[model samples]
Target: MAGTGGVRPSHSPTLPSQLGATFPARPAAAEIVRDLPWDDTPLGPRERWDPVVTATVDLVLSSPMPMAFSFGDSFVLIYNDAYADLIGTLHPAAMGRPAAEAFGESWLSPGLGGVIEEVYRSGRPFLEPETQLTVVRADGARPEQAFFTRGHSIVSDRRGRAAGVLTVAAETTQVTRRLQNLGELTSRLAVALTVDDVARVVLGYALTSFDVDHCVFAVDDGNMFRSVRRIRGEMLDEADERLPPVWKRLPDNPQAPLVAAARSGRASFVADGEPLREVASDRHERRIRALAVLPLRTASLSGALSIGYRTEHNWLPAEQALLNAAAQQVAQAAERARRFEAQHGTAQLLQRSMLPEHLPELERFRIAARYDVGVDGNAAGGDFYDAFRLADGRLAMVLGDVAGHDVRAAAVMGQVRAALRALALTDADPPGVLAGLDRLVGSLGAESRNEEIFVTVVYGVLDPHDGTITLASAGHPPPVLRRAGQGGEAPTAELVKIPPGAPLGLGGRWQTGVVRLEPGDSILLFSDGVVERRGRALNDGLDALVAVAAGAPSGDPRNLCAIATAAVPGPTDDDVAVLAVERAVALSRSDTMLVAAEPTGPSRVRQWMGTRLREWSVPEQVIGSAILCTSELTTNALLHAGTPAQVHIDLNAERLLVSVADTGTRGSVIRAHTDAMSSRGRGLSLIEELSDSWGTDPSVRGSTVWFELLIRSTSDSPAS
Candidate 1:
């Protein structure tokens, strides 16, 4: 063949001898080239060929490499037999056509014609090996998009001038796609946070990218192997029950490929077996042909991950290594999740113990409480609430918050609550109780914590008989008292007139505030957690809480607490505690009984209590505690105070309050009586321990000694 110059080239004769010897006799592609109808194409006749064009053609035709000669400005395509198979269906018709017309649209791709143009203009050879370029090819029978690695160079004329570009290429689509998929799988595993997250990423990617039929991640649960996740193609399914629950200790069964892998802690391949097939659903058993399992090993445990194929697959070292890397990633992530779960459970247990086991009850009153820890905090927070009955037939509610969200702060809060409860029992005044709490916090906190701890609290004593609440605040939010309304009118929540004192741990005297209420009234006591947020003003949160309380059902104490806590708009950086009390009814004469205060007063009180409790169907444990506390109070008044004493027993659905009034000015005090022999000092000590609360009130005429017991339902009582 010759270029279309209408003259025989100088090297034309020598090229034809070489072409004739290689064609028809040596190469099938040369025969296809010789028989091509050049006159009908753009290159014209063989006699008109340029020496450089004909010489380049001879070289390309005789070469065994996959090479092509694209001649002239149009890049006329002329390729050898190796190159013919490389282009697949584009071959026979592509022999003498332009480069763009031969490869169709892909010839103009940046990786192809663009490189050729650069080689033609620069007159320099361009070489790129293993570089991917998408092209058309036939995989078995149908044409498909494929990848190739190609090298291009300038074809020089006899006169040493560039004429065209010659390219040598090789197909690499399968190898390239596999490497790319592996790279993506590794990237996805890097970002996985938990065991399930890693399993989802690796299993889903392997099924689709590696053309696998099934993937399973099984974790070791000591006694048995538990499948964390299993995927069949694109669908997620439960593990097959027929598979071995426990990995085999020995590889005695050659039929069990997954068991063998687990026993050996190495990757195993099975071309055909009932073990792998039996693990598949009945519908997919016939479709599965091969399986591969990789052992997952961590410092604490061992497991196996399996990948199944629909068609028989030859084992490759690279694929095995890829699966092993994935297994390691999953092992680390699973360990992380397990440790986090354990720590979370421990913190939850500690917080639960710090809260009240059960709220104390008062007659004609309902008590509800809630506590929420900060979402972002890792340790238990220092927010707590407690409710118990006082000596004067009143309910005492305490809500407190210690600064900081750590174990130390929680410990301080526990100490403060215990000390305050002890002080409140001996003293009748809320402000006096808080003042003693400040001194106790200063003394007890110094040894436990190096850093200064601050605590805020709202303590209220609610008299259900009179519907009056006396509140004391220690750098805490004022309690809201909601008055009941009539005629479909909603209740209104108002901040009580309490004087805010310095927070506990700082020495300052505090004052008490009083708020009078009616039956059906509700009082909400909360920590700053209910009203404090990051970007908002404190007053806004307080106002929002009031609104939520006002609109909430005053009759339901629990519902009121929920609404008030939820009123905070955003994340609460501190713990929140909401304690609410609703006055349901007023106490009447029927609720009270009197007994003459004498040496026999204690026994008489017990007899009356047992009878009343049996009639009301109160729990046996509550009745026992009530009778014991009443006896202690009556005995103390008879011994400590001079004669002319009287006993008043008050009963309500919530609690039992017993008061022993005497005409003596002698004040009852809590004195330590650890001695085994001393009897006199143990009276008030026993009253403080047995009763929920106890106190003494003095006047010009006499002083009254009182004690209270919390009522319990039958279900809340312990076995007698």
Candidate 2:
């Protein structure tokens, strides 16, 4: 024990404990204490160390617990390997430094160094159950939260005087963070108004808390159970990448772990894979070797959270308690979401029941309608549309919007729509229909003092025989007209100007406007939502709708309706409703085909066009030019747009017009000044040279390239 109590030379770096004197059972601990040069600090050399210091260092390093000792007035520090892990990056370098110096900014903030100093000065033991600390991991640059339950005890000198402090710490960072997140889970679940929302909040919390491979939240769905799951570091499908994880439904067999847990109303923990084989419902579940299924059971709802791992794991008591608490919150949220969905569904069903489920299908009158809900899908929207045949052999179409987004609004809309239909069946005209609807809304508004019922509507009557439509507007956006070109004129879409009447709630005189519907012409009636943006003027949206509808492939009612409804580019803050009706073009004189985006598509178009033209008795001279121009346009669409092209041709009494449309990112066709014979850029040049009047119109999805050819007369010249 020569180097044990006296100072040793620098060359002889080994301490007495290295030769099995003090730390005989732990050579690693002795080496850690022996490596540091004690002669440099206030604590002096190892050989000159006091007996109390020797005993204390032996106790600090040998213990399995995270223990550390700060000696004398300077509080020189020495700690064990367990303590090294607790401090993260503060280890090794902090071995023999003073506690205050080594602890840095955290010394005064966490009050650990001050507490230790007090313990050494007063020779009294102090214990703190919970204390917060910030740690920067050795492998990471970001600082993370940590907590500890530390106890400081006094270490006395041989003279019975207060000499140093001995500290023992238990890091509670994991459990503390999990508990904090659990609290956050409750707050987040409170706002979860739907089942998907609940699943999103619960699944995300479970995944982070357990450090498991995956987690799923399953809700009872009668004979089936719907589960929304998330896996660590997994790439989800684009369609499934949204708020509230997408759910997959499975059989509600009692043998399944999640199902069993929900039915048993208790928490189930599986320690091995063999027990899970029968319980797992799919390959994903079968991979889980260990599992914890916590049932979320309440008076109103029943569900289970399945937390799993690929490797076997033991669930701790603290973890079980936290998971159980989380399950309770999930159950409450599930109940709330179900209630909201139920009420929302009832309102939606009520409104849809009032509207015509199927439109009147007639050869001459082609109608299409679309109704879109607002951004908040939790509530039923007030927008509605209907197409029906009147007793007088006329097509009646109506598009209306009530001024709210709740059950009350939907109820008001249903009453107004139903009354209008009833009045129409009594042979009322467009003005009479509006007059009845306006009075009905006025009465409903007076009946309900809770909300002021306001509505806008455009109702129209189409006479298929005469090809005329009479429309009436009640504080609604005017109907747009898509007119098919006559002679050599190009097709165009413009708003049908009509005198506006006051909205339904405020009484005003209603009048009708007559629109002469030519063959292949479309009439579009839409709600204010289609033209009223959040910040922009109503005229801007109206202009955009006309442009979009005109550029649609043809005067097809379905295409026109879809194009007009999606004219606005942002989220729909209010409900959107649109209805379109187009007069049929002669089937024998018109043709439409979808050309695939492939190399052989142009050849297919050429062959098909030649056959159709010959069958229609078109002149050979015109047929040849039409085929070549159409083939060129189809080829351009395949090359530039990289999408399938919609090819449409209409032969009227005065002209033959052909159009090719595609949906690609780029839009609008600019005039190209290239050689007409060049192979690469000759598509447009060929179209301009051969056709009477050729142009391109850009649409929301892509562009339409069209050309008009003047025909001599309506004749039955040739039959191929």
Candidate 3:
């Protein structure tokens, strides 16, 4: 037969020809045509043997596996139809051809050719479970040896001599890949600890270790589902793509089938092709090709886990089992964190309600106060401010901070604030008030184990009448004072620092100090938390308060108090109380005027009467009479009105009059004291008598008897 490449086919068997030349022919058995002899007969016995040899070669080559033969330094491949299918149409008639001439340089390999030669020379069978090789076609494309397994055997002659080497191989490329996937899945499962960890591991495995377009995991937070982790291949950026809208539009009639299934404590698998075809109303039918939804349920809550693929692919039973186990681990961790957060929230609310409601009112003072709780986690601190009206009508203010931050500290603050208020009402002095408070706190401390909870307080009481404040401190910041001027000028403020003492509950002695507050002065009291911030010195904070208060207006204590509080940057982190008192002064006295005059002459009295009565718009006759009366009174005082005389005047809406008096060696003795007298005593009595009423404040220097005489307008001058 002629091959496609124009090579002549040889009828002679190369293996027998080489063996016949090396060894003698042997006899054959009677019935079994075994061990045929090798001889050089042109139409010889081997010539008859050639037909059987050809049939054997045809049987081996027709087998499904690819087979090849090599004899006497020449090679031939008799590939079956299955092997031909693997090679495609390039080498369809690959039989009885030299290994080198048929496959060319592709057949030149030391490892493969040496193995074939060893089998032929040793007459031994060999098997390679896996082998890799490359095949070159007539075209320019290179076909690389995707994996394969090979079986080799030595073909022998009738003389038991090695004839040729035969090889059979089967492709195993798919099996090797399944093993690699199994390895990756095992590694990922080992490290998944939490729900977030499981989601990340599974999503990464799908994208990197399997054939997946995109993978996502959504965890339920009560009403809605949120994507916790997502992964994708080169086809998509998982971070950039929004999840399928169907995820958002879960089954509204119930819950999403995925969510409902998870909540029901079951897992679900949705095949991309069949499920949608069966259920026409499925909203996610068009969005996803395939899905495996597993519900993550623990003792407390339930959520869903899903894997998605762009192409329709069946999820194996093993993959579903792996995902379900991962979801359970994640669910338990979320439940623990939720419980911890709830407990913390409750403790915070309890601490906030323990502070005082509002500051008490003061008669001549304005009070402003504010308290802020700390933000440090769940712990609650004890910072409080209180003001109350004492029994004496004085305003008592207290600001204190209990050491520590916890439920115990808050409880202690409540007790201490109540004790201070009761003590303040009983004791008039500030130091005495604090001393009583300390005694009460000490008595309470005897039963408690928390010896470290001490209270630092600044307490004070304001006396409205004297505009004085007595203050005492138990290692607390000194109160601030802001004073306003009478004419509404800019005000000045100062910190009224009293002697510091030990904190309450320390069983140490304490003392009180006094501060005299003038009218329009304010007192500011605050706990140390306001001034003692992390990185700032307490003095710096105090100085800052002083500066802000100094520039603040003295309009109303409330307004000034706000300004001062605002001056300290806060969330006070402490309690603050400011009590301001403005002393009220009576500026106008309308009923009486005090006057001291010397008698220069009767004209001097007349001039005094003209000037004083003219400013009042009195009639000329009344003015003249007033001057005559004053002249008579002064002349009498110089003679009878007495020496070193002082005149006193009284005015009202209805009447006006003046009285003059002088220092006398003898106090004026009026008979009947009301005028029933003779003219000599009557002149002195008439001047006293000239007034509506009179009285005397006698001194050693002189006796001042002042009287009021009604001045009549022409309308009502009854002749007396």
Candidate 4:
């Protein structure tokens, strides 16, 4: 009524000055109504108006809310000052006219006239929750988007029959817009993975949705509270770098507005200064005149969300309901993240504790291990490895896997690892140690009443003084042994010959095998995860491991461990554990090259390998043999794999072992060596005749071609 400006009617005479006293002081729209010539219209003079019509007019004019009364069959309009402002430019002229004629185009708006007619015909009240319309603002020249909640109540004449309709329309554009966009907010929150993510999403959404100057989202964290805030459009969080910054840390003042709201379990509005002063202690907080605090309530989480405006503003019922609904969404999202993080944290902690904190610091032998969990990282897994010095001064190493991926499996694995260490301390013998672990696992399975407790393990004891390892396996894959070459002999690699006893839970006999390790020798102990793949045979995975072990760099145990774990080429649903124990030796020279999947790759490998061999003082004859053999392998790899290949060469005093590995499926056809005369299988023929020993092995990742060459001794004459 106050800010709205109306258009003046054309050629309309003003009422007499003395007539002003006839009507009490009123709003602009009501003053115009009192002075209008009612006798000229369908309705008679004011004094002769029906008692029912007069009473209705008095009721509409006295109220402040937007209300318009349509009287009799013509449905003449009689509205209060608030209604005048709602009608914009049509105010004074529309005072005594029919609603349809006065409101013009707006009268037929979806929720306006249609609702009014329904009430008039049925003598019933009709309501439209929300509907869009075009209405010109008092200060604008053109109409703009507007929405309103229309309510039409039937008004009856003195005869107790349906007469006309009285409409009450409350402008709800802001409320409706906010409600409609809430779906977008829900979608964003659904993907939130952590507590901090929920905070960022909630705080950011609230700031923009309510058009507030500042907003904060705080969650209860036992004694302390974590919060994320957005101030003047800048978002701030406590901990975020590699991950999305969620709620970090904030002051947990007990009497703070947010704390009070969470504790009160409801919404609190602060529109007055005295209340704002009580909550506003900081410089920024003191500038806020209005605040709305809504509690984030869920079964498992307690928190609060707050929005503040710099100026005084009253929150309506619709707005309050929308804020509460948003708070509910925030609560649900927070609960999901909380549960996931809790389980993830527990799984990681339990698995780490089961493995050795840091590898046993040993000087005589180099030992390294690596463990990677499957996709279900939230589930504690059974894969584990440990290396520790035995009481007899020998080193004991173990890599094992229990069945399933859950807390129970992890618990069993932990017990088995602990038992192994304890038994090894009492007796460094490999068979005794594994025998003890078998009994422990069987007892645990019986106690837990789990029928699927299958455990596979490899226990080995390395003698530093003699460079010999005693190993025992219980339904586990045999360990890989990479032996350094002897006089004029090529180095060799194979799965150690050992007894494959039944799994621990089956209570099978345990036996041990002994292997003599030459200087510069390396042995790899791994879990079934190294070779167990879906839709493939166990022997296929095992054969792939031997190829990887033979081709990998043997000088460093850590490097070998990494290469072995990554041999899968792609994702796997099994956890992998690798432990490599090597006997350091002299006269070892190793070099590697990455050959691109192009025509010129074989030439580059030849040049690189020749230079490395010459630098090592390799005999010219030996260098020529290596260079020629490596070229054929590299060429075959590029032609068949269609992907980059890794050329790894290891040369010692007695021999050189070189391999070319590729990750590609196109090589399957080439691997078969079809068409003996077409140059496809020619490379294999040359390798077989020139090299001492050679083989081709294929794994899930791809395929590998390897060869060994023995250098001639100085005492031996050169080939004629």
Provide the overall lDDT of each model, using Cα atoms, as 2-decimal numbers.
Answer: 0.65, 0.72, 0.54, 0.71
lDDT (Cα) of model 3 = 0.54
RMSD of 4: 19.9
Return the top candidate by TM-score. Answer: 2
- The candidate, 3 or 4, that scores higher on lDDT is 4
Quote model 1's TM-score.
0.54
Note each model's CA RMSD in angstroms.
Answer: 21.4, 14.4, 36.4, 19.9
Per-residue lDDT tens digits for candidate 2, residues 102-164, read: 766555443445566666667778775575545443333455556767778887778888767
**Candidate 2 similarity to native, TM-score:** 0.65
- Clashes in each model (backbone N, CA, C under 3 Å)? 6, 3, 11, 2
Count of backbone collisions in candidate 4: 2
Quote the lDDT for 498 in model 2.
Answer: 82
lDDT winner: 2
Off by over 4 Å in 4: 1-181, 184-194, 207-212, 232-255, 271-289, 298-301, 310-316, 332-354, 363-381, 405-407, 442-451, 462-473, 476-501, 507-720
| Error of model 3, residue 420, in angstroms | 1.6
Write the candidate numbers in order of decreasing TM-score: 2, 1, 4, 3
Judge candidate 1 against the unseen true structure and give its global Cα lDDT, from 0 to 1.
Answer: 0.65
TM-score of each: 0.54, 0.65, 0.37, 0.47
Off by over 4 Å in 3: 1-253, 256-262, 265-341, 361-368, 375-377, 448-451, 463-468, 482-493, 514-522, 548-720
